[model samples]
Target: MSVVTVRIPDTMDHALRAAAADAPSLNAYIVQAVRRQMTLDAARKLAAVDAQAALDLDGEGDAL
Candidate 1:
């Protein structure tokens, strides 16, 4: 629908081009890669917050 231009480092650009060569289109490959990374990053952040909350609750009784 909408088109956007992205600039990548020369090495990354070459790698992405090679990786997406078998993909139907460059856009599709980029979208898939971004979506996968976003999911993993969000999960990692949530896990860190959950771990911190558990640690805080270990010593505090009812405040948490």
Candidate 2:
């Protein structure tokens, strides 16, 4: 694994600390958050592609 540095405002840092109180470590919390965001983004992209495919199919039917 690679290490990356992140900078955040003091207020956000405090919030993150509070949010991670129950977490094993700040890094673990951030990793979990990043993974969740990645999954959500992937799902959104897939939904957009499926929607476009449906629209393209509808257009093909109209052209026939």
Candidate 3:
């Protein structure tokens, strides 16, 4: 597996540390959290794009 380095602000670093304290491994916790957030963000963006496309189609049909 490839590895990447990330630099976090002091506040976020502290927060991540606190959140990962209960986790078995800090790396695993960060990976899981990032993956979950990415999934949610992608889903939200997709929904917005779909909604906009539907609106555009409606407008086009109205013009026809």
Instruction: Assess the local accuracy of residue 58 in candidate 1 as a C-alpha lDDT between 0 and 100.
Output: 61
Q: Scored by Cα lDDT, where does model 3 land?
A: 0.79
lDDT: worst 10-residue window of model 1:
55-64
TM-scores of all candidate predictions against the true structure: 0.60, 0.72, 0.60
Question: Model 2 compared with the native: what TM-score?
Answer: 0.72
Q: Which sections of candidate 2 miss by over 4 Å? A: 51-64
Off by over 4 Å in 3: 51-64
For 1-64, candidate 3 gives per-residue lDDT tens digits of: 7798878888798888888998888888989898999999987876777554654455455542
Which scores higher on lDDT, 1 or 3?
A: 1
Compare the candidates by TM-score and give the number of the best one.
2
As for candidate 3, its clashing pairs are none
Superpose all Cα atoms of candidate 3 onto the true structure and report the RMSD in Å to 1 decimal: 8.3
Error of 3 at 40 (Å): 0.8
lDDT of 2 by residue, 6-34 (tens): 88788799899899999999989999999
